[model samples]
Target: MRGFLHLGCVYAHGVKNVIHVMLENRAFDTVFGFLNHTTDIENLVGKDPICNYVNVNDPTSAKACTSPNLPSKSQYDPDHQYYATTNEIYGTNDPNVPLPPVAPMSGFVQQASIGALKGAPIQDLQQVMASFDPANIPIQATLAKEFTIFDKWFAAIPGPTQPNRVSAHCATSNGWYDNSKIIFGNNCRSIFEDLADAGLTWKAYYQENPPSIDCLSNLRFSSNIQSYSNFLSDAKSGNLPSYTFLEPKYGNLPQNKNTYTDGHSGSSSFANAEAFIKQIYETLRASPQWSSSLLLITYDEHGGFHDHVPPPKAPNPDGITVNDPNHPGVVYSFDRLGLRVPVTLISPWVPKGQVIHEPNGPQSDSQFSHASIPATLRSIFKLTSPALTKRESWSGNFESYLLDTPRTDCPTTLPSVVQF
Candidate 1:
């Protein structure tokens, strides 16, 4: 539904900056599958219906245009299953190519053990789904050795956005379970609270003035401190918050048609996401705050992309069985994590070409949850707060990459941060 533009431009900010790039809805299997050989790129880059009209002179004609990759249904039904329009476009389960069999237990927990469970039988679809090879893991070492910390959000658990996002802030995934639900408030005692308590200055920069209810309410902070569309302006004015939470603009652009109407593949969200990110990065790079700041780019959740590896089992407090919806009686325990989402940590302190192949969990090689973010914040500001949860311990710690040499790959100069 949405169209993508090759902006073909690079913008940079000033100095004393740290940026976190959250790759939303990035399925580990999908990303790794394509990255495995690169030919699989088609699996993700579906033909955007709006692309045909992106630059067309006629808005009416653009409205009439349609991409075959559009989603056929509005919402997933409990009884009826849904198939991705992307699959139908390419005429196969995987639009790219039939991915190799997912390795058994191949996620953060799995990789921590160096694929020790490859010979074990994959018990379910979750196991069969995690086929991403760690050999080509994208945790650039340069980034890892220099920046604060590099890790995965590890959707290794299940449920939906609210729970996962809560996990990102709270460590425990039991707070909320639905997209339309609110689990936390402004005083919800998050990493932001911890930072503020420690006399640190941090703010969340959202793309839209106010994000959806969940994002707006979950953080529980007032709109005065949060700027959805003014991130560019804030950066340009050297008004960098101690921490910035960048979110996708949803679907306002023509390229992101599905995001607006729900009739398409939500490719517009992706297109807008890419453009917004470029702008943010460029502005951040050009800002005076580039050197001292840190950026954490991560997605809130995976958007049901085919992953080829299995997420390992962690203790689920709410007993939400990941990947299994058949239990009509009650939420049951799942033996795996949720899908894998992409997370990027950018800063002057991050090492170049360094990949941290850790699990993102408290244990070595374990993957992380959203709750880990607060932990990282806590560490950065040296805050004293009760542990968000058991997994919270694994969330923070800049020691690994903090000592690495700074990246030489960054540009010497960048574009000016945009003004509101």
Candidate 2:
């Protein structure tokens, strides 16, 4: 097992607070992948050349292209369900077998067709293959250019929201492989618990109700969770916790209108998500903690959108594997990571326009997933003991991006989205 001895050596220099904000759905390519068309950004992070198609019937006549626009509200939800995602990754709906070593990642369009045809109209179904122009999401594109972007960051599971999110909070998802298993009744030890045990301060701020915080098994720390309204006040007062997890509003239901900034499927618009992020950035920049803080912005999963890169092999979280009861023959060892999602690291300690896609040392893998969240917190907080899981213990930390001297000219504001 890797020891926490490396923690003191790495984080002892600066960095007092770490703020992580997790958004919903959007894929790396679905949002900023088009930035590859620009020479400078392309030279820095390379590109994802995978383009999708749309064909409900006659597969031979399928049109090949990337969807160009993502409206504020989607008419149909992409197929991000458990089994659908498996097919999206493996290019086959065969749940009876383990994923082959050579996953072609070519089944997105096919699986999406199945999902779209279920209850959606023909027009809505065709939108699955569509993507947004980088020009459409100016805020994210601007931030990616100004801050450090992790081009290879991935979700923790090949499935949907809940499982992958659980992986982010605690290295292991227990035995879950789908969102259906997620409920308020589920319990697990999370990074919050680890932080508390080490005598550190942490907080979970939600726009309305807390989706992720409810996953925690121990209710003793419930007091640490607060409303999103309190977050801005805390930042203004310089009373932020050592670690903070910000949750966006999950949906745009009537009650959620006030807090609904999450960019989930069928929501008002991605502009809301960008605005929410900009608000956080501006608030943090004005806070006294700005100099000593690191902010991470990322998504939970691909949300059934298309990402060209294949997930790499991963360490099994707890040396345990579970067979999918739904598909009697399918078994998972938690040894493979999920599809790619955009992750950006912002801190004055990081260089402007920095792209982190490879491990600093040759011994580690370049790819990172949601497990890196707990792994990083464990390392920085010096929580010496067994890690939540072996996978997190082995995951790479982002400390390498922090420089000896902080940059004073980082941007204080980002571009706004231009509505059509």
Highest-scoring model, TM-score: 2
lDDT of 2 at 178: 77
TM-scores, in order shown? 0.61, 0.89
Model 1: number of backbone collisions: 85
* Model 1 ranges with Cα > 4 A deviation: 1-23, 36-153, 183-188, 212-221, 252-269, 317-329, 333-336, 359-365, 395-399, 412-420
C-alpha RMSD (angstroms) for model 2:
3.6
Computed on alpha carbons, the lDDT of every model, listed in order, comes to 0.43, 0.74
Query: Per-residue CA lDDT of candidate 1, range 324-379, in tens?
Result: 24333434343335655655566666654344444323454345556557656665
For model 2, what is the C-alpha lDDT against the true structure? Answer: 0.74
Q: Could you tell me which 10 consecutive residues in candidate 2 have the lowest summed lDDT?
A: 40-49
Tens digit of per-residue lDDT, candidate 2, span 1-420: 222223346544478899999998877767766665335432213433444444324457453435566566664568787778778778666765556886776777777766754545444554554567668777777777777887778888787887887788888787777766656445767888888888899998988665566766674358888898899999988999989999898873577753467677664677778789989999999999999899999899988877777888888888778877777766777877778888888988887788777444212553477878887777667778567887776676777568888889988877776553
- Model 2 residue 398 CA deviation (Å) reads 0.9
Q: Which residue pairs come into collision in candidate 2?
A: 67-130, 67-131
Clashes of each: 85, 2
